[model samples]
Target: MTKRSSRLDDAARAGWLYYVAGNTQDQIAVKLGVSRQSAQRLVSLARSEGLVRVQIDHPIANCLELADALRDRFKLKFVDVVPTDPGSESTITGVAESASAEMERWLRREQPVLIAVGTGRTLKAAVELLPRMDCRQHRVVSLTGNIAPDGSAAYYNVVFTMSDSVNVRSFPMPLPVIATTSSEREMLHAQAMIRPTLALADKAEVTFVGIGDFSNDAPLYVDGFITAAELKALQKAGAVGEIVGWSFDSEGKMIRDITNDRVASAPIPPRETSLVIAAAKGPRKLPGIRGAIHGGLINALITDEDTAAKLLG
Candidate 1:
């Protein structure tokens, strides 16, 4: 073999001996006929060259305790509780960063994958934090409409950002957030181009979404996607929060009102999706997050420690 290849082979061996076999540098040196210092350098070289990887499996006590409580309370498949200064903006940032790391790991899977995404500020932040990679084997589909009434894809559009970050194809739902009428929504759903994307969303292995509280400060109203009167009506109808434009009550049952029919994007039934991961944080989001969990809208969650405590309570 060439000198470079031979050196790499030796480094790999040294790394295995020191890390895996629990051998000292001196022992590695004796086995490989190298000096102790040379063995140390070889292990370092192995790590720097990506021939070896180290992982700490030790769990943080507080975080693990909170995670366990949340999982048990909500019957959640997975929960990640990130430490944050309570009530600070870092609450959102911490959750978003953790969710971003999880997304990167999921995208690294060797099998072809489809990731459905929902729109919201937290979800957008997670997408922005995601590491850039060229994952052409994956497809991203939007679980919400791309446009608002004012012809803007401004805040509640994350599919494009995800596609750009990962360099993959994205299928945005080409419809308005709230169609003017039920018939219009039906017509939009019937379109040939829209059908396939919706079908793809139904079969997605994993979906990332955000939970939105149904107060006056609701994103739909604040972003001008819904009128003040509409927000009031939703609240009157016993809505507590929204998931993918569909509002639900505190008990997690869909509030089937006019708004439900007017929503263009069809809600992906939680049972249909293998994994529904919701990333959210903050006191304002706690009610919505709880509603989602109670309703079985999401199986996994990523949120800050404070929010996790609140949810557990």
Candidate 2:
């Protein structure tokens, strides 16, 4: 190698060794007989000249554009995009984990009531990765009714898990999300026992929800909350996706239907709360995800890279 190429190669090797070996600049510099600043500068030069080739195996591409598209379309304050690597569960898990880290940073600000909507496998993944919420005065509310039997072990378990994580109270809605008839819904809402929780939902400061597909395999259907007939009806009615059971069209516009009315009645309006949705998956969720962006229901989003690329494209 020529003199220039030889020095560049040494710098490239040194930089790779430092990065992979988890050594600090100082350590690399001392070991290489150079100043820490010189080591840092050389690493940059190596990278710029393609002397150092770093392979990051990202699952998805255009994550930044996806984040920008989501923010622009939804008018959100922030959007986190994670890469999708179908072959790697660990990569998928890392995306979810990174989203949780970003959420932690956002929550550091003063927000009164943080609402969590229960729907979809992605939401579950995000929640599992969510760091322990440790603000005593702040509260976390359940955005939707539980899918399990009322007061059942599973219901309480989910509620307690969320409550304990934030070290705050859970505004539990102790009622079925969907009722047989409008009259039944009215009666349930009239009851003193369920009124307080519902009221708290109405006053939520921040809401976290998941978007859903109309497929039977969708998270809501698998949760045992909706029947196959309901899913079919939603699809027939041109419903592309749903949030907290409220169906919307491909543009995220609310589809005026009995089911939608029921869903809207069950939860507070997005306009009245700081709405955030944990969005993920690709192609499958695009219609519903796009609907959310159009409907002004979601003001913040946490999503994976593959889904982001689709949205931006």
Candidate 3:
């Protein structure tokens, strides 16, 4: 390497050590076998010469076109595309990777309220990718809840995981999503504990939700929210998939079934930035996903190539 280029490299290295590595000038000097003053000078040189540039590493080219297409088609604020290999583990892994990056961005942004929803494995994977956040001014609230006794309430994990990521306020629903009768639901809604979170959902600035399929193996179904009998009923009713707990058909029209009515009944009035970040793959989700898109429930989406192609198709 040239003499000037070598100096630039040394300066850049020392600058990175001081900033990203959390090293003091003296510490950097010790590590680099230089005096503290020299370390300081190098840092200054790196900055002055523009050798230190902060780059957000994202799969722009591969993901951007698809992202733009979704955004334009669905009026989404943003979309993330994961171009995975055609088969095998590509779908889940790619979606997970993109979600991790997206979650990091969401946590970093200064937002007032984040309303979350429950639906599928892809959402679960995205929730798993969230790191513990430490922001104090933000609030995270669940958009819906589980109803059946066997339902695992995976949305609780979404709340817990997101709360850990940012040291912000968290609101969790402590009731079944649906009651056996309207009277029972009315009583639960009257409870003070549930009312506050319901109020929070009304004021949500952004919402993160996953889409759901009507199949028996759907994540929500497997999580015990939907029983085998219920699956059959939904299938017979021509129910396709769900968005924020609201089930619909192939064209995204609301099914108005009992189970779906439970979710649509949330107290919250949807926010203007009511973003539904749906992440899923496969032909099975096409109807449900397209329905969500057609219904205008999702203002944002993040998914893999296969899923995106299917949706576009």
Candidate 4:
């Protein structure tokens, strides 16, 4: 092997041990079977050679200030604002990963608590980032039905994926999120097969949901779950956002729309002491997030710094 290539490999190993493994110089030296001075030199060399790239996972002072401001403004229970780069819009948008960390924190608790989850791209992305753990002590339930009107499963049903990650017992509502009619939804909700799931969903103290912005790019319309006319009707009814397929207006009140009437998903409004955390970000979601906060639909929030600033603005 070339001497240069060998050195590069050593530097990479040193970087991984010191950064990823959270090892001190003494520990790294012992593990690498080298003197502490040599280990320190290796770590410095790794940084100089660009083998070490440390990314801070904790929120910076600016982000913490933003979080505190949002919480105070809305009288919320918890808030996390992921740091963003002014020049790099893409780099600062890891809200899903940050939310996943919060989810992990709650799941790691020894007490077995009921966790409810909503469906969307945001939630699916967060579930995908979860590290597998033995969390069978807890229970997880879906806040929305798993199917579309066409009988196909919803594209972003997240409880199953979350169950796989944490080894938790999961209950998924097998019906469509929005039935064809109010009567159909009533019939679906009344079914004995779905009763247990709905009942359990009602008891969840910790809930994670995705905020859907009412815009030209609304996920319900884009995913073919709701027709263009239905979307227009929802917008006309003053729906600024949706959670668990229930459309709400700027004041956070459920609008008088057929969409809300036909929704078969478990209707879980903010309960006393319930922790409902919504993960959303970007310019389009500012109004929707504001609406959710105004209505007390979500007591906790996870978002990026850019969106938080826009919401406050």
Per TM-score, the best of the predicted structures is 4
Cα shift from native, residue 44, model 2 (Å): 36
Give the TM-scores of the predictions, in the order they appear.
Answer: 0.79, 0.70, 0.73, 0.81
On residues 84-133, what C-alpha lDDT tens digit does candidate 3 reach at each position?
56657533666655665666666677755564545345655666666556
Assess each prediction's global lDDT (C-alpha) against the native. Answer: 0.83, 0.64, 0.67, 0.84
What would the per-residue lDDT of candidate 4 be over residues 1-313, giving only the tens digit for each residue? 6898977677778778988898998998898888999888888898776555444666599899999999999898999998765666442247787778788888899999888999888888778777778988898899898887678888799987776657988899898888889998889888998988888887888899998877977988887778999999889888889998889999999988558888889987355656899998877777788899999889999988888888788
Q: Report lDDT (Cα) of residue 244, candidate 1.
A: 82
Better of 1 and 3 by TM-score: 1
Which residue pairs does candidate 2 place in steric collision? 82-305, 252-291
What's the lDDT of the predicted structure labeled candidate 2? 0.64
State the lDDT of candidate 1 residue by residue for 78-99, as single tens digits.
8988876754654366777678
Least lDDT summed over 10 consecutive residues: which range in candidate 4? 84-93
Report RMSD for candidate 4. Answer: 7.1
How much RMSD separates candidate 3 from the native structure? 9.9
Error (Å) of candidate 1 at residue 176 is 0.9
Ranking by TM-score: 4, 1, 3, 2
